[model samples]
Target chain A: MASIDIEAEIRAEPPARAPVQRVTLLAALSWFAAAAILLLWQDLTFQPLVRELALIWGAVGVALVALGLAGSRLGRVGRWTALRAPWLLAIGIGMAVWTVLTAKTGLLPQPFFPTPQALLEVFIYDWPKILHSASFSVWLLAKGFFFGALAGFAIGVGMGWSRAVSYWATPLLRYIGPLPATAWLPLAFFIFPTSGSASVFLIAFSTAFPVAVLTWSGIASVNRDYYEIARTLGASPLFLITRVAIPAALPHVFVGLFMGLSTSFAVLVVAEMLGVEAGLGWYLQWAQGWAAYANMYAALFVMAAMCSGLITLLFRIRDRVLVWQKGVVRW
Target chain B: MVASALKTVPQAAGTEINIQTVSHHFDLEGAPLPVLDDITFDIEPGSFVALLGPSGCGKSTLLRLIAGLDHPAQGQIQVAGEKVADPDPSRILVFQDPTLFPWRNVRANVALGLEAQGTLKSEGHRVDEAIRLVGLTGFDKAYPHQLSGGMAQRVALARALVNRPNVLLLDEPLGKLDSLTRMTMQTELVRLWQQSGLTAVLVTHDVEEALYLAQRVIVFGPRPARIVADLQVDLPYPRHRGDPRLAELRHQALGHLGLDSSW
Candidate 1:
């Protein structure tokens, strides 16, 4: 072989391939293949499960396209040129058109779940009722969260701030905290005239106790040096407790609040199942008694979505308040 | 005569204070072990002195006694014409550790001494002036975590200075620092002492450090420690460690402590 012109060859050669691009390409291709396979096999799977899962993937694909095309001039394209967005929009339009056409002409023999007119009735005439039900459930959850978080924070602060309380009350709390709030049904029904008040009280009580205990434990676990330095710096006992101790123990307190909130929600639903005539749990119970399985399932979907949203909001608040404690891993 | 003169001189200075033969012991679980014995010392007005000894030689105990942080069992500790039995801001003690509050930043730490004494209103200048004197300007907002060890200790020094005490007790303040940082701190300490003109009692183990910084360095022996030597530096302010006289004195003092084998 002819001797290579080293300098010229080196100068003419392309840059060495980066592993990052290769890995990213592999990941993107794998994800696209999985989505395509899932979407194509939608008809062969359990119809309800397939529909729910397809909706989730379709939402994801739509979201990607929407976000990608939002700031760009891609929207001006006549549907074909814009790869991500066009594909998503075409799929949605095609599905809507097919559903309408298939109903107008009885072409595909038998349909799954709801016929076109039934789905239309649920979407149009029954929409107002569904909205009312969802809103009522959300309102109940909001009330439970507010009362639960407040009581929990106070109890936590009290227990955490004082050693005597934490020492004496912990054993009692450990026993009480684990016992489900539903166990108090007989007593609650006896004391309160209506199940509504009893439900609210039971949920709040269950949430507050654990929140308070966890907050107190967190405060107690803070480093002794923090307190000693405060003393040496001439901070009065009161000032030390309020300014230094509380702020330092805030992270743990919030965690306790979040935990309490989730627990309260769970207890609220259980309480509704036993007692109340309102709220999402009450609605689910009513639907189940009427043998309306779809309504019961729909109510469940609403509960899941609402709880996820509320929990996300709580975490956001936790992150904002405890930003300084970022990089410090918590147990 | 010197003892009699030391006694009478306090009266002449118009301060009716006396530190009679003092001794202290540590009692651990009802077992008493003596640490210092018959430690008789009288401080005159506006005097800068250093208590020099090796580690575990009870130099810190002597400072703590002066600050009223510790009580002497067999003797008396008098400060500014009065006896001391409890901790007070009047006779401030700066321990070896910076001990700055981790929560409070530099400004708050400096203001602490005045706040504790309830003299904040009358002595607002003290806090600002002390912070400025310590060369920690523009670091008011920095927390202890943000500060280097030297800076944190400087804030501690400022806190003590803000109290405007009759006596300043330093218990090996520079002992924790590395050699370079320690040398820098020693210079800063001298500047502070000269400007403040308050009576200071430094407890240090370094012979040269004590000699260079203090007018008098009181050396102590091992366990149940007592003053073994009271060597006077007699050198002028802003002393040079490289000076032949300082080197010779340091060498001789080192000999007394079995430190300079060449001697």
Candidate 2:
């Protein structure tokens, strides 16, 4: 009977794993339709990007068809691609629709609203100029952010840790924190030696307020038990502040940094628009002056991507540092 | 296995604690609210004791006073003949919540007391020894959130034990664990106390917990906590839970806490 039971257990089949899917059939069909439309029809006006866009859509459709046929051998990328099938299909259809409306037919005006190729033309021809402006913007933002974050962190820690510091800083923060950084444009320009210096001060000013406010709250609201625990373990005042208070309040400090980044971005653009020599905002103004709206649109895309990429990076760093908090605490 | 890295402990026996007319109160909205009402007690060296009381009776507050985390409004607490003016690493307090720094892993958490005192450079091996003693040798890299409640509590014990404290102040250390874990830990606690020779003061509300582990059970009444009875258990180490004497002592303790003996 025991030998029979062993044989029966051995004969039982294992639980089936989920099947590996590539792309949805509809997604492959959507991209193929888009590619066919672009390759077959002649646009009313010649758009250089039309051929490039058609090739991209065609390649995606081919890859999806190949992946579906190959199954799991393609690995992780294939799995990821399968998850984004609906999004890929929607984007393909939207792109085809945009090409029809703008290039194939003169539905939108020319000077104000250009074809897809016109926007791509700025990157193709004027990349060097665009790169220079973006670099200048990055430099100014980096300098301002570094200084602002440092000063704000110090002041916030000071205020949170000491009652005397809180007493003096509270009134000033209440009075000045809410004023927009751009409001000081005229005065800052007059007071500072150069337009560059003035813009740097303005960006720093905007970044400082949010960072300081949120950091102060974070430190102040730290659980009292953390301090007590450290103190009971013979922690000095310095050790308590550095080890217990700061680490305990780190999640909130990250929140402050996030808010500071966005505010600094706004101030950077405004400061650049007002008087700075070269930046994305200056490029936008320069393009508008020549009525080159396509350049403006291209610069806007760069700005949105830059800001979004930084936000995503910050979140990734936070997840790594605060991994232990996944179960213990939630914001 | 490491051969007791804590062999450098200068004071092998536990320190004596004497609380003299200690009272404390909190200021609640411009009114004085009394919490501990003239509590007095003396604990012998290298003995296990429990301050058993109801939740709102301020037993934990008295523990805080003894640890010097807070000052008593009226009286003084002396440990080893010196008045406790501030918290010292030698008299470590382990809270009910494991309270392990969530940012730190087990090894780092156990090294905290030594790190804070700038002695971790020479005494770092004590961290591993404590971990091994707590039966968590392979979990040195696990964070507090990754551990179960009992495991986390064991980590807390290791963190305190690494300091080689003369007096261990336990504020309901096993209160949050499941019943099975609690019983097992009671045995573990007795074994640890016998091995280290450290004076242990545990504050708990469970009657059986007070009787099973502690040599002396100081029972307290409701809010504005006052000692109702101080019953001594003259039992040897490795006690049996089914022993009839524990049941009889349990009845006495329950009677002191205003519960009927029949129950």
Best by TM-score, which number?
2
Rate residue B263 of model 1 by lDDT.
Answer: 64
Across A78-133, the per-residue lDDT of candidate 1 in tens digits comes to 12222233344445444444443443333453342333333433434445665676
Error of 1 at B156 (Å): 2.8
RMSD of 1: 9.6
- Steric clash pairs (candidate 2): none
TM-score of each: 0.68, 0.91
- Supply DockQ values for each candidate: 0.22, 0.65
Model 1 error, position B183 (Å): 2.0
lDDT of 2 by residue, B1-263 (tens): 11143332333578999999999999999998899999889999988999999897999999998899999999999999999999998898989999888899999998999999999999898889899878899999998889998999999999888888889999999999999999998888887787788899999999999999999999999989999999999777678889999999999999999886467
Evaluated with lDDT, which candidate comes out highest?
2
Q: After superposition, which runs of candidate 2 have C-alpha atoms over 4 Å from their true positions?
A: A1-40, A46-71, A329-331, B1-11
lDDT for model 1: 0.67
